[model samples]
Target: MVPHVLGSGPTAPPMSTPVDRARRGKEARKRLPRSEHARWLPSVDRADPVGVLERQGRDRLPELLPIRYGRMAASPFAFLRGAAAVLAADLATSPHSGLTVQLCGDAHLLNFGLYASPERTLLFDLNDFDETFPGPFEWDVKRLAASVAVAARENSHSENDVRRSALAATTAYRTQMRRLAGMGELAVWYERIDAERLLPFARTARGRRQVESTLARARRRTSLQALGKLTEVVDGRRRIIHDPPLLEPAGAADAASLRKIFSDYRSTLSEERRLLLDRYRFVDAARKVVGVGSVGTRCFIVLLTGRDANDPLFLQIKEARKSVLEEHLPSGPYVHPGRRVVVGQRLMQAAGDIFLGWMTGPQGRAYYWRQLRDMKGSAEVAAMGPRQLRRYAELCGTALARAHARSGDRIAVAAYLGGADTFDRAVTDFALAYADQTATDHAALCAAVAAGVLRAAPDV
Candidate 1:
């Protein structure tokens, strides 16, 4: 069971002192000194990056594993995003603070973005949770820090800029977490990083305009828009048009099987949600390839039409596997892997997709369902200059801290971080060092593909 460092009750002790929570956090420094974070010591028995990649592809479709490998070959940042298992192994061998939170096990820069809440407001938060599980809170921060460094390096930023961006992230996390640590529980729970709050962080007119343009584009990405673009009238009925490899028709037998699974999925929803869901009639399902790491997994797009031919609802049912951190950290007390993803997502985000639920498919494969695309906007880290990247880094750090604060003892963590740059510099040092390791790993993956150990379909 996950233990709460802060005791619970109507008259809980004040967080400032509260039986020296801060003192304990400060004491943790002695056990795992901040300076030690600068090191990335891999043991002799560490898993080979290529071997791990091959093992992950075992259960995935053979045809699509090439695409997964190809995406990772694109760049070191892409490889880092896809190789969560590889990094998790390394991080598990590193020093930790023994503080645990629901982690976004793959908390790369691209994964922190804007998505619409149930109320239709776009909120910025961690958008990926496929690898989320209980582990050292530092793991998430480390991933984010390393991602920022790698991305800055990929964009050809100066070494100083890269260090600044990395430090900005950890410093923002430290500053924001300390702020949240002093707030009332409800206040912290209600806080969110919406579009309006993010504008001030834009350092230039171009950055501000980019934010506006991205928001406008996200707001336009509704179900109706997707329906118009992805469907066509065939046999006097609406059907999802095929875009081979990426989007294609599910086989007749598979579609029938999924229809039954929809009923089981409905049972997992609340009564109100079930009534709302019943308004739509299932029409068709399609296989959809998504994300760099998730390419080979079984992901499907289910179409449902409501009210009239113009009204549409698209639900993505993505396969869930054991978290990347499962081997590194203690396993969570969840029977269904899909449920684990759903619950971890809910805990880490201030709000989530309203249709979120999970079901077990044939052979007991776990899958979770949510809206296909609801005003989702991801930062083009490729285009970001040093200034824009630094601001983005700070925002992502603050966002991650808020997410961790929700699930872990904010007081203890904040106190541990304190008001110093020691931990910030240490994480930055580690991020840069790991960025080098990622480059080496990416080169190895490219070499593996070239040597025919793995096939790569870069265009796909």
Candidate 2:
């Protein structure tokens, strides 16, 4: 089925005035008070967290299931990273503000990171879009806030500090949304967080040094760097090096399948990108493991060359399944899951990879393709102190608000938030309560593994 482009159908209503939009937002408060966001008790019949995970894994590679479980079992923070489905179910049990946007679906703290924009400038924004879908704006906010709380607690921060970090994230989000709400549509559309702009927010010589180091490291993470690290001269020709289970050569059949789908994927790109892609010659591919939640999916990295071997381009093909949100919210526009991801990323991200595209692969599996690494880097959340974590949380919150403003009704959301810290405090309470729930769920997973109900391989 052809997906309907938003704001284009004949039935679409005329654009509402800012006053009307603000009034609508206030009306929603009558249905669901901003303070109600703090509520987070699991229902009596809430689904088993492990069972929810198992169901998600049924269609994934069986051999890789153990890695997924093992990674999640490592800690409560790790469990939260891999348990988007669990959180989706829990969030569905609570009422929302109905302020919809293209959610990152799994907007954990780690998911916000640094990447190169199309103009080659470094920027910070929501980088992961594997589970992108339309849903209540607060779902993404809550997930991000909860992730901050979990990470802060894992770092042994005081409970007061943990809540403070979570509150920092929510407050940044609210204030940024309100700021964007006042701007013209074009201004909001052009908004972006340049990596250079983040340095001043570090607040100390040490923190500023760390930020500089991260930006430098991200700058060095191009495909050429990946080529040196992930490939080697074999028989006088470069080929991907094998690292069993994590990075292994794709079998002959799998290699051929990727090549066959290459043209189909290219067709999805714009004419200029298609011409740009034609400059590269396919070299080699490998079956790769990625992210905590994405571990078991079919993933591959294809090496290509432009002018010569020295000019390398690496593209990743990752399987795209129905979003975890799909089961809880109303159906979205796109029938093809891969298209859903690509479109969502374009809609929400200020600048996106030029290589982003999608296609159906072998056995009707849907997959999206993009540059494997283009000066990409993520913050080292594990090493952050309380002050640093709170600052980082604020940055992530600001980025999330910019993203939400692009796709959702910013005026309404901003009006609902107002100048009060009620929504911020409410969400912080939810984050702490949900962090406790995540700990309980993590324990359940470990118990299942111990009982042989689930197998967990050692962390790779």
Candidate 3:
């Protein structure tokens, strides 16, 4: 089956024939204006956003159920927490005629953090791509702004202060993208952040403390330690522990299909990676759960042990389906969305997990796999302050632009962004405005839950 590319033009493969290809090439060569629908994605009503998210996310829930929340525990605004898809779709409908590339879909302030790179460098990046897909440039920026706005309101910041922080974030993103776009690809790839570099930027004691904690935790998060926690010899049988709401042993047919998928994963590797696979035996594999938004999707963890059973490697295979962003994405040229994600990730991030690979299941269900816990960790967003929120936004925006530049024309975007501060200011305006929308939406969710209109286990 052919997977259609959305906004990605020539960056994707041809449309089968020369005449068809020529027609697409001609349209693509022209500055592709942002579709009218992309722009309004950010302007959705707060009440409507929850409905949209629930709808786009409906297909996955039967696979894994939501851990119910206590009505009083979730901050009123928390309900609107991950409304990035609604915002992204609206943003895609908006305006622009510049370079387009794959986006993180939901580049919120809370999603950036420290993790170990292949070479063991502590790196920062846009970590969550659940909402990832191709769309207008501003969609990510606006979602980021709204996150801060909603978070700040929860934290009791004044409206003006929240707006200012959001603007600062917009400024940082625009400035960083322009700066990085000026560098050579290899140089950008070499760039990374560690605890030492953060000292200069972490202004507050809280920020400093948080960074120190994350770095310390990251250092302790080794493959050896994860092996013990995620796996064990159960009752004389060496098996992955079956934890409800987390690990699943799989039905007979599912396990059979999984074995084939696991076997296929080996061939997807390179000579170097294939050699690495020889170092460990696939001891136990099972379907495991992960992440808030990704809960209902199928996720599996494969455990490996080598030599004296001391050496270990873990791989995570996650089902990749049509992104909710695809609701707004009309098919174009690319047939495989998972391939698009892997390719885009390689382009945008400075470095990626060496084990990254894609596969299609017997049912044509697509998925991508990587190391399960190679120094994998994330920041506790609930602990951040307003200042930290702003700075994080800058990181996400900078990273988003860099990722977008990987497959799209950086020069054209830089030109469209103009040789000035126009783009930054425009983003700031959008952020502040959208932040208001997010707050209003959060309130509606709270009221709905109170009135028993929309069901959530009371926001626990």
Candidate maximizing lDDT: 2
TM-score of every candidate relative to the true structure: 0.96, 0.97, 0.82
- Misplaced by over 4 Å in model 2 are 1-14
lDDT tens readout by residue for model 2, 351-434: 999999999999999999999999999999999999999999999999999999988888988999989999999999999999
Give the lDDT of residue 230 in candidate 1: 86
Model 1: per-residue Cα lDDT over 1-460, one tens digit each:
2222212211222455634867777787776777777887667897899999999999998998998999999999999989999988888777688766778899989998888998989999999999888777788999999999999999999999999999999999999999998898899889898877778877679778888888888888888999988889998989999998899989998799899999989988889999999999999999999999998999999999899888899999999999988866655768688998998898889998889999999888999999998988888899999998999999999999999988887777887887888889999999999999999999999999999999999978
Candidate lDDT (C-alpha), each: 0.88, 0.92, 0.62
Off by over 4 Å in 1: 1-19
TM-score: which is higher, 2 or 3?
Answer: 2
How would the candidate models be sorted by TM-score, starting from the highest?
Answer: 2, 1, 3
Candidate with more favorable, higher lDDT: 1 or 3: 1
RMSD of each: 3.0, 3.0, 5.8
